[model samples]
Target: MDKKYSNKGLKIIAAEIQGSSKQAIGKIIEENNVGFTVTKGAQGPVSIAGIPHAVAFGADGKLIFKGHPASEEFKDVVREALRDVKVVKENLGGLVALGDVIEQRTWTNSEGVKMVAAVTKIDVDKVVFRLQKNGKIVPYPISKLSEEDQKLIKGMIEDE
Candidate 1:
């Protein structure tokens, strides 16, 4: 679904409210080859009573549709919602969105420990990353990362 609608400016975020652990969610994502963001231990804006539920919002952030994503009705609503959607590359509050899909990469620390994540937001002295192993968002001091990682992040920001 992400590959199909990402070009249409549709951001799909699936939240797992079933009390799944990070490791469990990560395994499921890897096994299913999920391309979109899957957050664990999080709740959506509305109340949900079942699994495999979906809620879509328009470009204006209003509730557009709520149903199973595999349903034809949901697909129709998405298509209609996307018909007038315009992709915006503008900055989000102080956060920088690296295009439609944030590029994930392997980052290393000074101790040689490595983690795969994507840069979602950057601060003056810190960087926020969305972990690839699990959909956990974390903020770390820029100085704690490797020198090479620091350069890469700085270059990305400068390019923006």
Candidate 2:
């Protein structure tokens, strides 16, 4: 497999096609003259919500496509199938709605005092943390903390 597309962590979905539907997909592949292989397996859960199945399409034994229900290259086919369905616009901002408090523990320089903090706001470069006791907001530079400390802090916050 080509290293370029053979990401170990990449997710894939596989499905078995039979009858007329299989013939249609096969015709498309044959028309395109792209090499591919099919394998048999039990259906499994999909990482993407809307997608239900995933498969791998390889050319010359190298993976070129991956995703659920449709190979990456054939995603448009799946999209067209779902075109008629009305999809509700999800409020991305509402995913972590305000007042949905997540308790996090932090270490204070004043001593190694473990303090509870609330995640008020999170951004790419900085995080807004407020002391749970008095609600005092403090900003922490993400670069300042070591990876281990970050994990520790994250674990403490999620523990509660």
Candidate 3:
């Protein structure tokens, strides 16, 4: 275990299950010169799949293994967890979402007052859109918009 995961910033715990001896674990740690925080035995034995059970946790707090630590599956899982740890150390931020979707709808309200807006949302009784003049959600009632615009808005409501 020391040779495989030395200097790899992994919080490994060789826990004792079923009230096992600590000498064996201690001997192994001493021989390997393993730099671990806690090599002590648990207060009470944990009964999972019997005594010796190894569990690996990734940097993202996800489980990697819960069985024998010396198995092939454990090695593969540890490698993957190491990769995740490395990636997390290098923080990732999302890229810009520029002009993904924009719609220019010409809306005319009551008293023949016309206005051009970027339609953001169309609801059952109102159209919530960004006014072209100033970027703000303008809640224009469906009853106030022009007849043709009302038909389109009603279609949107029916589609939902």
Best by lDDT: 1
Residue-level lDDT tens digits of model 3 in 1-160: 5445543455565554444357776776689786664455554333357445777766556665678767899888888766533211111122111220125556777678888776566666877767778877677788987887787667656655
Candidate 1, residue 155: CA error in Å? Answer: 26
TM-score of 2: 0.27
Using TM-score as the measure, what is the rank order of every candidate, best first? 1, 3, 2
At residue 86, give the lDDT of candidate 1: 48
TM-scores, all models, native as reference:
0.52, 0.27, 0.39
- Kindly report which residue stretches of model 1 are placed more than 4 angstroms away from their true locations once superposed: 86-160
Please report how far candidate 2 places residue 18 from its true position, in Å.
65
* Alpha carbon RMSD to native, model 1: 10.2
Model 1 lDDT tens row, 1-160: 6778675556778898888889999999999999999987665578775778888877677988887878998899888987865443343222223432235668999789999877778777888889878889999898999999888767756766
Residue 29 miss distance in model 2 (angstroms) = 63
Clash count list over all predictions: 0, 6, 0
lDDT for 114 in candidate 3 is 85
